[model samples]
Target: MKPAVGAIRRASIYAVVSYGGLVLINNSGLQLPSMWIAYLPMFIGVYVFTQWVDRKF
Candidate 1:
């Protein structure tokens, strides 16, 4: 149950980042390159960082 809760928390964070990025691209006036491209590195970085942190602690 404790580990499940942590998994839920991490999943929520990922969802927020994904949807928030999409919303920003839709609402923001500033022109930019593909929004998904910008977001990919961030998502991957966060995932990798989380794995590293979990292993360390």
Candidate 2:
């Protein structure tokens, strides 16, 4: 149960951070050759963060 709660917490954090970042980028008027390129780093960062969070708690 603790692990489940921790997982949920981490997921929420990831979702909020990802959404906020996308929103900021969209509003910043920065042009990208491809959106996938932007997503690549975000996904990688979130994955690494999730892994760290899992190990942390």
Candidate 3:
């Protein structure tokens, strides 16, 4: 697989797992409103960093 594609796939897996865990935690009592907003930058940031890493390493 291309480096970019691999990076994206791994990032996606991470996003899904993290989001699910957060939602589960929220449901259990840590109500954080509009968590998607928090995740937006993180998602982009992770992608950016992963791309940089993929290129650098």
RMSD in Å for all candidates: 3.8, 2.1, 4.7
Q: 1-57 in candidate 1: lDDT tens per residue?
A: 989977877776667665766676568764666766666776687677666655554
All candidates' lDDT scores? 0.67, 0.78, 0.64
What does candidate 3's lDDT look like per residue over 1-57, in tens digits? Answer: 687877786676667665775576557653457767666766676667656655654
Q: C-alpha displacement of 11 in model 1, angstroms?
A: 0.5
Q: Which segments of model 3 are wrong by more than 4 Å?
A: 30-57
In terms of lDDT, the best-performing candidate is 2
Candidate 3 contains a number of clashing pairs equal to: 0
**Most accurate candidate by TM-score:** 2
Off by over 4 Å in 2: 50-57
> In every candidate, how many clashes are there?
0, 0, 0
RMSD score of candidate 3 (Å) = 4.7
Ranking by lDDT: 2, 1, 3
**What C-alpha lDDT, on a 0 to 100 scale, does residue 5 get in candidate 1?**
78
